[model samples]
Target: MAAQRTIDVRAVGHVAERIYIHDSYVVTFGPDATSTNLWTLSNDGRRLDHLKILRTLEEPGGIAPIVDTERKLVAITGRSSGPPELHISDISSGDLVRTLMLYGSLDDVRMPYSSRLGHALVSTRVVDELPRVLVVDVAGNGWIAGVAYIPPDLRTSTDDRPDPQFGAEHITDDGDIICSYVAPPLPDGVDHFTLIRWNGTPNENTLPAVRADLSISLVDGDAVSVSCCLPFCDDALLVSACEAVQDAIDTAYSRWSVLRAIGLRALDTLWTAEPVWGVIRRLHHAVDAGVVLATGTQNAREDGGKNIPVSFIAAFDDKTGALRRLERVNHIAQGVSVRLCAATSDTVIVIFANGDMSMASLDDFLAHGLARDVDTHKVATTQLWKDDGKKVVHAALASTSVIVATQTNLVVASW
Candidate 1:
């Protein structure tokens, strides 16, 4: 294998709300959410060339542009002269393909890579009416395939409590809508949040039936925290579940957390792994790479409440959970959190909160005996870039390169 090469590209004045990357190109959303610029990598993979300016929406609505790299399309929200609308355009030609007027102000939009062409789930809110989620088909002439209003039970609150709010909502490729709703605390004393999945496509004037209520459906009946749940591969959800326990030694309450992969459609546990670190936090589900990468942290209890941060890069076989390994990441300072992680098939790139970057090999494993005997082994890694608090805005991993972007610069490291 060739030695890895790191290159720094000056991206002054190229700030963006978000960045999306493919193996061949990179797309940056305008910081003001008005336009998007598509950039193609140079032949030597060291520089980025301006491909074309993709003007998505006609009017600014402060809606962030969603780039679907798999479909080579960009979706944006606007309200020029009529109702709030969504615009779909091609990334290559920058040609407007379809425009659909929405029911009200667009609150959020989610597009699944495997969804039908020009299809997405959009949430909108009206002045006096409750929020509604609409299934939009932007092909040819725009049309609304279905609509689902917020349930009356979830729209109101008790006299003493505040109104329940919706958290993260996802629309799967099969038209399954998964929403997280958090309600006021009940007498049970546990967090009253539920992960609801509506299976099947919603038809005109009819909402799909709810298939699973994940809050009370698990074997242990522990509420799955939506903030720690990650949607994976359009069909699976990576969940980090924590259950309080009474420590026998200290006679105090402690928490035990485990990571599991749950199939959204079948409503089954695909696989589970217990990390030595008790807390599972940041997660990356790289389906294309066939591995799930996550970071686990635990504080030291013996050191007078001082934190001994134990951060590990765990790799798991996505399908069968055949290969499970916990490797400690070297050189990360104490109390510095991992802000972003991007993984390809063979490489994993991590950026710390302090603007330091490191790359590790996912394919290279420690010897079987050594890994089994030791509680944690370090993955061989290379320090690609470091800064003293410049702050990484976003990062994306492609087949041949990893791109890290800060407010003032873009760095490309390729092998």
Candidate 2:
């Protein structure tokens, strides 16, 4: 007698990997949910089994996704923005299987990471005048899985290269040397956007003077937003977007008035004018491979030419790329223009609406310690600081959309 539900499960969009105690099977993400490539779910939201990885126009793209429900298998990683192909899909029967052939040029981006014994790390952007770091390794039986082609510039002499267990190199303080990149996050002299470990040694792979002023001009550069993370191995979490945003923060009334009280020395002088971090170096997991996560965001560079396209996030490595916590978010009468940057996890548990919900720790979004929600004004939950011991936060509820659980903190995405 349990059949007449009619179809209105509160509007829909509620997939679950366990939100607390609710699993009716809502795995939605079709209908171009803002532009597909949503997280290889398919447990019951319908289909795509494992790595069907589709957005197709003929070789489509969005790589960095896995489903492996004990090997039922699902690893989708796609990429196709006009002649840029690197796809691998096999969601039980979706097809495409294997296809990799990608190269990069200019303000390039290709960051996606994942691990937990699955293997899929891709870091692209090997264009030099100065800006290089190309790494690719994808193994999970779709095939071409392990060639280990990471050589754009890490100044090789080869001792098998890449150490520190795996993320080797990143010795900032004034020595400069962070070779363990995850890709798509450029322009660095290092100040506060890290996922490092290179303590010394740099024949070439640059970027680490520590910002007085760097400029790699993307112009306004699509209102910069960079994210770096290497969750556990010592320490690495660097988020940058020093603010000078021209447009597109995505709403919330322009991220609450450009997230007030800003200071990043004019975005580090547009990321040091334009050397693009000397010459790239991102070879995480060395070559054996295991922990990876990369992310990037852009939309604030306008010159009538407008080439705003930088959105990459390879996953699984402490859950998601190295991002501890950092929130600014102002409120200029809900226009919510553009402030930039948002990655959460450290455990946030919100529910609020007056019913009240609070659970914070992402280290209080660093430097300030946010708590706002004042009846859903936003930022429902935010706390991060977990090197592994429990103390996380990046929770959001009410409308739902903020995920990064399993110690990375920032949950609320049942769909």
Candidate 3:
């Protein structure tokens, strides 16, 4: 009924306030935390063995810790005060390998490590200036590539004040980087969002050239809520936008969220899917699989004018944008919001806002109604963290394990 392993981080000298898991290692850190507390959970999810605890930056910066599985490194950000710093450590030995102080603020969240080239990308800003993207060679311990929006000729101009912003979001498995640039507001109050790609290596000047760009207009006060690189397809991105529309009377506005699959090569819209009534809150890709799952809640008003929240799950084909499955979820009581959704190759993990978790079989859910004899095939679902009162702070679905961080304990559940 339960496949779970709970670790009392407090008893182990940690509050488990933050957790990052990748491949076979799980890292937990607090203000006074150590990397030596990282553990290797067995594949069966029944046990975990802690490695020698190596203390790291006790007061790391505001950036979230990142686990680079390919290079077997863990990158923790620097302190909040000074120029940003990146501390990289070996995952196996829990040893600090190198620390690189970057020219940026720790408040910036657009930092991602590229394992292919052993580089890290971060956005930096100066006083009253726009942000610039920089790439540092983690292995070489030097700045290798960078891109500046303010050209040399314009930097010295006194009258021309153009407000633009650029930052890197993700690095593809191949070494190419994906970035976003927000252009200045148009005279009509419209904004433009441009997605750029760093195709190849930088030139002799250490400047990266923009290989391709796709710009989308934000008219009528529309906003881009979320954007990220699509998994399994490096040449595509997933974007969610919220568009506000005026009613026929022109007195009020109503908003709707739209999800789009965009191709980078041709800068074209591959497909678009809009939820029936609500915004898409969580997006997760089943790694190495052709499925991406989206979960959200729909607010519908009844005849009595009472608003009710209904949670739903939607599965889409990663390549062709075909709708694979759409179902409404009611695992818990009414009015409970869905907190997070993570998918693996064959499992869909759902964590509710009330600290309840559920794991459903993806294969069984997709196989339903396919066989003639099995008229009503029900997907086998397993309830996790049953009756546990602790609040779920964060959760992740790795290869075969579900990592959940509660207020007092870190729970790992596997199939």
Measured by TM-score, the strongest candidate is 3
**lDDT of each prediction vs. the true structure?**
0.57, 0.30, 0.56
**Model 1 TM-score, all chains together:** 0.67
Please provide, for model 2 over 250-309, each residue's C-alpha lDDT reduced to its tens digit, 9 standing for 90 to 100.
Answer: 321121111111122221211111112111112122112332322233332334443333
For residues 191-259, write the lDDT of model 3, one tens digit per residue: 345555556543324434443333333235433333334433667767554443222111112334456
Candidate 3 clash pair list: 36-53, 36-54, 61-78
1 or 2: which has the higher lDDT?
1
In candidate 1, the residue pairs with backbone N, CA or C atoms under 3 Å apart (3 or more residues apart, or in different chains) clash, namely: none
Worst 10-residue lDDT window for candidate 2 reads: 253-262
- What's the true lDDT of residue 353 in model 3? 55
